[model samples]
Target: MDNQKPSSGGTFKKFIIALVAIVILALGITGVVYYLRWFGPNVTDKQEYLYIHSEAGFNDVYQTIREQGIVKDTTTFLWAAHNMNYVGRVKPGKYRLKEGMSNRKLINMLASGAQEPVDLKFRGLRLKTQFAGYISKQIEPDSVAIISLLDSAKFVEQYGFTTENVYTMFMPNTYQMYWNTTSEQFFKRMYKEYENFWTPARKQLAAAINLTPIQVSILASVVDAEALHDDEMPTIAGLYLNRLKRGIKMEADPTVIFATGDFTIKRVLNKYLSTPSPYNTYRNTGLPPGPIMMPSVNAVKAVLNYKQHNYIYMCAKEDFSGYHNFATNVAEHMANAHRFQQALNERGIKK
Candidate 1:
């Protein structure tokens, strides 16, 4: 056995080796911590969306995330957010929280302001309030904001519309837009779509028919209201147009129902015709000041391409097939009306 006292130099060398090993271990652990903070999967399985309003701050966003538990290991996410400087760059949007997304990717997306879009859709809106309410549900603004914008005479004038007629500017369609769209922005987009729809050819057709775009929309709403089946729209539209050309009162029962504010009125009685409202076509000589409802594209086209006929009157068909009976004279119309009244009486649909 060659036993000898260990030299001081040898002892120091061992100590140095141990120190290097410790340093390497520490570096390995630190690397893992950093990687977990930045690159680890932070979005939880609870996969939901994150909706930040137009004017939200980081605190509001964080509070929502924290309260909703939208993420996993928020501790590491917070650290990464601070380190990556995402706290100062909060973007308002609808963010889809994808599963297995790392903190770095989420932070980058937020910082870069890349947000998902929303599909906004509406149809058969009978009133301006209904339109506003339906639109508000999918966007950041409230119904009050939409109603205020629609009611503002000055604001609507730029779009070549009056407060009463501005409702016609919005065509029923599925519009892909941002969730944070402001009310003004929504109106601007709708106006753009409206312009796109009313092309030069349609404009010429409207002019040839002696009706403005707003008037066409008004008539389309009435046509849509009277015809439950789309196939009957053209004939119904022609009948109303003929009535208009002949200077005949529309006597639209739908308008009477609208004026009464009783949407449940199954039968437009004589008393309901007396309802005092500008919307009551039974009293008004021409198209009402605004549309009774948001008109469909089909109904609108039906007005533009109305079937040429001598029909000046119409009533719902007696068979309840959602079709109408057309007439060129009041005697025929009265007979049709009597049949419809008899049907109504048999069905007990009295208001």
Candidate 2:
């Protein structure tokens, strides 16, 4: 009976040891799993940004993460993502990935749809298509999609703009926006900006000048295209306004270049003057149908406060300086034109 008690006690001790060992092993495994799920650094130092597309699922996101070489362990990230319910909730945006970010932080940010906004700056765009192209480079919508909206007369008319003058609605400036902004959203945002730009004070100025807002924009575009120097814009605007007041043809060379669809024509030739388009200010009696190019805010303001001058004509200086020689009579303008023509001939810039 004593030997039987001893054997039973030994067996109980062995069972206790086995139970303790199993508990320790389980705790070790749980610690490792916990570290991987929430604490371990998943992002690598080499990674800078992560772009999650709108249609991306778990596999697509995983592939992108792997391709960027940011995650430390793909399997651990997958496990954490699956557990955190971040597998199917992929958000589309430009994400700034920081080094040493844990799976928990990364997954939480992505799941919450916290994406960085893109700074979109558009300047010097001449056509609506060009504006669309510029916007498409920064946003989710493609060029074709944006162009569809820009060209749709029915859609643009809702914003009180025609297909021809629709380009004026998008003022050129930097905007902070999300990357997934739709084309319609972008247009509305720009229209809002356009409205904000034409404040009551600006509207009063336009009324005082006897020009509508769009007309002011058109004239500003002409002035912008004509003057290479910003300081000379007011003078150029004054000359055009004088012509407008006298009921004379604006006879702007940029309009002819726009009509000809040839931006490379540095020297406006007589052949370009005969173009039959309404945009040909030499042939047309007043302003063109719309702006030839996107005008700057300074250019628009210059038109609002034009310089008061009696000079009725202008010709490019013969010295190749981007300055113009102003004239009150046809004889003086002819002299300036002859000098410029001679300079162009000397430089072999015919046609």
Candidate 3:
């Protein structure tokens, strides 16, 4: 009986040991499966990148980044990002990354901010038009809101602009800005760009010509409207400069057309020329209060470095090519005008 009892006790100890081994082995298998599924070969350890425009939602951003293979697991990435308090830090813009970037690194990049270049060309754009384009493509600010902000007199005091006109301040060029940049920041950056463009030499030239930078910009906008070819800009600018010096009304048909804000190439009727606007050069003398459109740098430079000439009048030649006939006297201008009119009549165009 004593031997049997000792044997029974050893058998019971063996059974307990076997049961503990089974449990430990099961746990190890479970741990291996979990690790394989969550952190194994499929896990992306490299960086990844994606681009998002302004006003893009966060979920859209997540999906984009995931599709770009920036994040290995969407759920895990989101969880980590959220846990690390990066929910608000992910700005809307082009983001660069590689697979396997740590969540911390991603978060830091997001927090550091991303900048994108916005090419706002001054290619014959008025202030309202430029602002409209800027709001549409880049900042997504409300048009009415931006206009109201521009119209507010306080902006002048805040920005140190002498003119009430907001369009006079923006220089047309390719500008770089953060994707999440505010409208205020955009305007501030534009002001800085304007300051940079208006260097001491440019200011001196503008003053020497008895024109403000804004006035030069306004004249450049007119030159941009009138001159079909870039090469003709300096000569055309000289014609207008002489006319201005002589205190003659520019009588530019382009200004009349620009006053209506219609770009049709049809003949300018007397009614169209009579359209009442401050921008109408036929109706008003000298430069308009501001630019009709954003002028190119070359056009602005053409106005600043205008050629010296006694020419006071210009008309498109009868050839209908892009060249113009410049005249110092009324008789020559009338002859050229008659020839152009004759050509227009032959083409069945009524002017």
Candidate 4:
């Protein structure tokens, strides 16, 4: 009877051990299945995919990824990413995803920080327009917020520009930038691009012309506004340079129009001349402190490599086809200006 009792106790202990082993084996298999679903060969199937926006944070990223049917279980995906230290590694940008991506592969891709390039166009933009466009495309910040920030004197004072013209800082070009890039970073990158274009040789040429780089750009902006044809730029630049050397007031109509901030070309009445604005070349001489608009590289180059000439004044030819009449003296300029007025009358443009 004693032997039978001992045998029964041993059988009970063995049964308990077997049950625990079975439970552990079952759990191991389940864990393997879960792991394989997310990070195994099953991930290559094209039917299961996700598109992730680069700007999404970890939680948002996981949610978007799951919504696209890339991951069957959010908890498992989050767990895997966390365990692999990929939470901080995920790049902000558009990313193609597949199901069954291995934790290692996903983490590696995130760590690589791949970004989608967004084209930022700065062509023919005024400062306000450029700021609005940049904020809309890159950071999605409020236009008012950006304008207010740009308007702050303390913020823009470091650039060494006399005028608070933010538009002048940017060069008109299509730049590749990340979508979620900060405004400060965007400006920094643009400044870097500007520096790249303004090489030492260009700087020497600007110095030879007795103008700072910013001043050159400012003059270029004026030249850009005045000249309609590329071939006419050198002559226009030469004429302006001559006037500057002679300390003559640059009575440019464009300056008067810009000062008025009105697109209409109605007569530059005496009242318009009194308009208080820094852009008024007629009122405030010497490059108007800063650029009125972002000038193209060609315009800047034209100013730097201006042709030498004694031409002091120029007037748009009556044809308004962008050709100008160059004059070496005030009398000659007045005659050309009369011809321009006649042309304007013929076209019924009362300017």
Best by TM-score: 1
Query: Which order, best to worst by lDDT?
Result: 1, 2, 3, 4
Candidates in order: C-alpha RMSD to true structure: 1.8, 3.2, 5.5, 7.2
Model 4 per-residue lDDT tens digits across residues 1-351: 545445788999999999999999999999988766456642345442233454667778777666655555556657778877778766665444555567556656655765446676766554565556556655434566566656767656765443355556677888887665666676578678878888999999999989988888888888888888988898888888988888887777777887787867656766788778878988876778667767888899899989898998888888778899999887998999899888778888765
Off by over 4 Å in 2: 1-26, 45-47, 67-70
For each candidate, what TM-score against the reference?
0.95, 0.90, 0.76, 0.72
Give per-residue CA lDDT, model 2, range 232-305, as digits (tens): 99999999999999999999999999999999899888888999998999999989989999999889999998
For model 3, what is the alpha-carbon lDDT of residue 316?
Answer: 90
lDDT of each: 0.90, 0.90, 0.75, 0.73
Count of clashes, each model: 0, 0, 14, 4
* Candidate 2 residue pairs in clash (backbone atoms < 3 Å): none
Residue 197 shift from truth in candidate 2, angstroms: 0.6
lDDT of 3 by residue, 217-255 (tens): 878888887888999999999999998988999888887
Using TM-score, rank the candidates from best to worst: 1, 2, 3, 4
lDDT of 1 by residue, 1-351 (tens): 989999999999999999999999999999998888888888876757888887888888788878888778888888888889888999898888888889999889888878889999888899999988989889989999999999999999999999998988989999999989999999999999999999999999999989999999999999999989888899988888888998988989999988988898887889888888999989888888898889999999999999999998888899999988889988999999999999999998877
Which candidate number would show the highest lDDT if scored against the true structure? Answer: 1
Off by over 4 Å in 3: 1-73, 87-108, 111-122, 140-142, 160-164, 348-351
Model 2 weakest 10-residue run by lDDT: 1-10
